[model samples]
Target chain A: MLETLPLSLDAVRDVAKECFDDGWRLVTMSANQIDDAHFDVIYHYDKDLTMKHYRLTVPKETVVPSISPVYFAALLVENEIRDQFGICFSDIVLDFGGALYLEEEVRAMPFCKVSVAQKQS
Target chain B: MARTILPFGPQHPVLPEPLHLKLTIENETVVEALPTLGYVHRGLEKLCEIRDFNQMIQIVERVCGICSCLHALCYCEGVEQIMGVEVPRRAKYLRTIWGELHRMHSHLLWLGLFADAFGFESLFMQFWRIRERIMDIMEATCGNRVVVSVNVIGGVRRDLSPEQCQWIEEQLAISEKELKQLSDTILSDYTVKKRTVGVGVLTKEQAYQLGAAGPTLRGSGWAQDVRQTGYAAFGELGFEPIVEYGCDSYARSAVRFRETLQSIDLVRLAIARMPAGETAADVAGAMEDDTPKPVSAGERRDIMQAYNRDKRHRFVTAPPPNLDLPAGHVAAKVKGKPDGEAVTRVEQPRGELLYYIKGNGSKNMERVRIRTPTFANIPPLLAMLPGCELADVPVIVLSIDPCISCTER
Candidate 1:
């Protein structure tokens, strides 16, 4: 079962901290492209067997605060989102600076539709 | 002491897949390790935009050759949920049977690899020999040794005959006996213990915080399993999660070793309780006069209309009459494309695999994200790598059973 909670960019850190303090395990984080300019960042957390999904929508250039301080495992997926979607997170503990999975030669934000469209055009 | 940077594998003898780790070592002790990936990345998730939902199953199954069935199963279940298709009970049972068989074969293969990692060549050969029997059973039942494509949306694609089931039972019994002897050797052998027992320790807290799953979490004494969520037929089979408190490589190996036997038991239980019915619901046909009628043009047109309208409709397609689907088994089909999002999680052989799929009421999917077990396991592996001797790197790495294909896919 999943419970989706709407969150703002500012409240994400506090809410994530609360979840972490509540002994919730960080499952993974995903960045889904909603449109050309808007993206939805989902933070998945699990406690016992129930999954809680916190979702916040941000513009393409918005800098989402890093949740790595609350959940260390967040660094990997956060870096991945940065690499694949060009979503930026501030103050990541192990920041790869958008070089986590892709190489330097590969074009950035391969999963973002806008970026792919721009490259194709 | 000067720090030496050791580049471990875009190619390595012990690693079956390509994983490059930049290990900074001081006097043979790894002080820091950084992993660089993408050597085997096929961009499979991105392929979802081009492939329709049906074709995505074939691509997802190839995510990891070892956990192929679980990937297809997870993808199907997610799509089925989105379409709200009720699979037949017998199909669920068959899925459980094949799933456990896959787990058994995967663990046996890992045992062989783990033994080889520690230089136990004889043990490695013995484990692989036992694994071959399981492979033969897979080939005999599913028509392929690896990447068996038995799972489809709403239900499975094939059924096992009574004779085939009995033959599988016999083969499992023989393999179990051989595995019992091998387990004794593994536990008692000093070399195996020396290499695995206290190396790469991960406490329960660390395991949970690191998002470790499957035998890795179980080895650290956590009983969390996605199977506990009762997906597929595991809920009906009285599934129990095997766990160990050692929090070390040996504990992880023992967890996997015991799970192979547990999986065999699961298969036996599934066969004994196998229901008498059809393996799939007709996805594009209707029953008339106690006979399945071909999908009418009107119905097909209605389905197309529904697709254009962005409405969900169920359809049925009957399997070939001569196949194993028992008489009176009806198929439940989805008439149009899925237009919603679903999150499906399945416990693969390695760990908990999650698939996030979003459909847009068209033939093609909008987005698909696969969180493979190995991908989740990488952070924990990095945590384990540091503070260990350079020589123990391969053993510790293999202890997690990193599947680069799954990770990069």
Candidate 2:
């Protein structure tokens, strides 16, 4: 079962840090394009076979704080979200500068609905 | 001393799939390795926006050819959970049987490839020869060797008869005997030990911090496996997670080898305790009399011809109306369309595969997020590569059994 806790961007770092301190494993991070302006970023944590999800809603241009400082594995998922959705994370330990998955020739943020809409227009 | 840059594959003979790694080497030791992917990216998650939940199973199965069954199983489970449909008991047991078979085949394939990576050509042949028998069983039972599309939203799409089950038992016994002999050599062989022992070591703490999964994590002494969570019929079959504490390339390979044998035993147990009943649930509000009628041979041939003529087009659309589906194929039917989100996690052969599906009370899903095992395992692979010598790169990479198709999907 998955439990979603909606938290402000400010609370994300604290919640993530607490989860890390409590020995929760960071499973993976997922980003959904809720709209043209807002995106939902979910951090999935697993402990003792139970899954807890922290959902943070941010605008397109917001630079979310990196959780890699807490869980080192978050670097990969954060970089992947940066590459796919064009969501930037501040102070990533190993920043690929948005070149982790996609090549430069491909349009930025291919998974973003806003980009698709813009392309259509 | 100057650092030399070595680019390892978007295409390399050692790699079965395309993955690019830029290794910065100084005096034959890798200082750092940077990975870049997307060579085989097909934008499959994006396709979910157009295809309905029912049609998305075919696409999900293509996420990784090696662990195709688990992909479909996870996706179907998520959708079924969303619709609150309880799969039939018999179907659940059958899914366990087939899932174990797929795991065995996949591990054997990985063992064969790993053997070849270290130039054990004869061992490679033996492992692959055993794998072919498993593939034959899959083809005979599910009709497709690689992407066995036997999972529907309500339950599985196929059943095993008693005679077929007996044949499977006989084949597994023979393969198990052969694997026992192979494992003896793999574990004790001097050359294999020299190459693998004390090489590319990942301690338990590092593995956890790096988020390694499957055998990679188990090799470092972690007994974490999603199968223990009791999805499908694993809860009934008494599954156990295999682990090793060597924390080296050898330990990773040994974990897979033992897991393959364990899967064979699980299949045997599943067949023995097989439940008797219908193989699929007539989902809520579904037509009770809308049973699928078998297509004629001529219609089957025509459909096959069309499928071959334009395979890419079929990737984007639903299966043809008059296609000859295998027996026990059930069209997913539900009381209402999926309106909320659900997350499903399954133990793929490589590691944990997670799926997040959200629907907006329509035929088409709003978002489908797949966090495949290889995608999560990449950071760990990169973390292990930096301290190793150039010659050990391929061995360490193959030790993770990286599935690039799954990663790029």
Per DockQ, the best of the predicted structures is: 2
- State the lDDT at B302 in candidate 1: 58
lDDT of 1 by residue, B280-358 (tens): 7644212112222354576546555333554565547743233253334233454567767788899999999988887
Position B347, candidate 2: lDDT: 92
Model 2, CA-based lDDT = 0.85
Instruction: Give Cα distance to truth, residue B64, candidate 1, Å.
Output: 0.7
Listed per model, the TM-scores of chain A against the true chain A are: 0.90, 0.89
Give the Å error, residue B46, model 1.
Answer: 1.0
| Alpha-carbon shift of residue A59 in model 2 (angstroms) | 2.2
Candidate 1 residue spans exceeding 4 A from truth: A1-3, A116-121, B282-334
Where does model 2 sit among the CAPRI classes? Answer: medium
* Residue lDDT tens for model 2, A1-121: 3469998988878998899778888889999988889999999888766798988999877889999888888987888788878888988888877767676566657788667321110
Model 2, residue A56: displacement in angstroms?
0.7
DockQ of 1: 0.52
